[model samples]
Target: AQSVSQHNHHVILSEAASLELGCNYSYGGTVNLFWYVQYPGQHLQLLLKYFSGDPLVKGIKGFEAEFIKSKFSFNLRKPSVQWSDTAEYFCAGLDYGGSQGNLIFGKGTKLSVKP
Candidate 1:
């Protein structure tokens, strides 16, 4: 079965630091990619997504991700991160045909931004 991978288990940075979270997907066919963020006590919110068209898509806030089909990778990036950006990031994958079913999420990356 295809899966999403987030290599960073935990990330820490001071406010205003740059952030880049790596993500990799293992789907053989067409797939949809997404990045979701969950605040300390809030529900998950969609940060960005890529279904088609441009491989480089911008998400809410300053978050952005680039889809590299050849490498089956969709990595999230932010030139600068703030304390308010502290949250759990999840990279998700959904088979285009099997979507409507469920979203396969990564193990989750906990980001801690110190003020």
Candidate 2:
């Protein structure tokens, strides 16, 4: 079994400021990492992911993450954030490289951006 950890419980920022969310997962074998976001009342959306090959990966809406195998960390970052980016961010991990079952999720980090 694997476990995910999000060190940031809550973050507050102004529009256009940079943002970074830390995510760490514990697993001995090969694992897949993800960052998911949810608006106030919307369902979870995939922000970014890492599997193989590139350690640095980019995703939709100007979001990116770097996968550090030795540190077991996959941190999410955005150069500039918007008020619309305000949402709850979750870190998840799968023991294997496949998404066959439910993802082990960390308690979400809530981001509130001031417009």
Candidate 3:
């Protein structure tokens, strides 16, 4: 009973441009991946995470992510983007066993940076 899907709800850029956001998850076993960002009022900030070896992971401002275990997918990249990176991009998932991490979000992707 795990679910997390975000195929871009609203994303409009201009400042610098270049940002990809598309995360999908249905879980098969152990999973822990997240990419949260909220800058308009600031609070949630962890632009990358994939609790495992390393299927490509990087966090912070210049975000990056790639954990494609059989296409469960975890995609969030930014080659070039500014205007404070605008914000509101959440794609989280945590289902290890007993389920206590308490994070299964993905109904947000509002990034509008027109400067």
Candidate 4:
């Protein structure tokens, strides 16, 4: 079965600090990468995703992700972070291009951005 691994379980940062969360997947065939964020008491929202075309994909809130197929990594990055960005970030992989409806999620990385 496919799986996603987040290197950091928790991250703490100050406002305006740069952020980078590592995400690696274990899928051999075609796969879709996604970054989801869940704020406190809020449902999961799509931050960014990469299925095809350009490897660099940008998302809302000045967030972006780069898909590196050779490295099996789709790391999320933001030049500057804010306190409001504090939330649980998840990395997910859709196997076989989402054909079988199998989505493997990571344990998630809790980001605490201090004001």
Estimate the TM-score of every prediction.
0.94, 0.93, 0.33, 0.95
RMSD (CA, angstroms), candidate 2: 1.9
- Write the number of the candidate with greater TM-score, choosing between 2 and 3: 2
Q: Candidate 1 on 11-43: residue-level lDDT in tens?
A: 999988889999999977667899999999999
Supply the global lDDT for candidate 4: 0.93
- Cα error, residue 64 of model 1, in Å, equals 0.4
Provide the lowest-lDDT 10-residue window in model 1.
94-103
Q: lDDT per residue, candidate 3, 1-115, as tens digits?
A: 7899998899998977888889899977778889999888779888888989989998977789999999999989898888888888999998666546678888979888898
Q: Which residue segments of model 3 deviate by more than 4 Å?
A: 1-14, 20-33, 45-67, 71-73, 77-82, 86-92, 103-115
- lDDT for each candidate structure: 0.92, 0.90, 0.87, 0.93
Q: Which lDDT tens digits does candidate 2 get at residues 47-111?
A: 88888889999999999999998898999999999999999999898755455656899998999
Where does candidate 2 have its weakest 10-residue lDDT segment? Answer: 94-103
The 10-residue segment of model 4 with minimum total lDDT is: 94-103
Give the Å error, residue 40, model 2: 1.0
- Write model 4 residue lDDT over 1-115, tens digit each, in one string: 6789999999999999999999999978777899999999999999998889999999999999999888999999999999999999999988765456667899999999999
Q: Against the true structure, candidate 1 has what lDDT?
A: 0.92
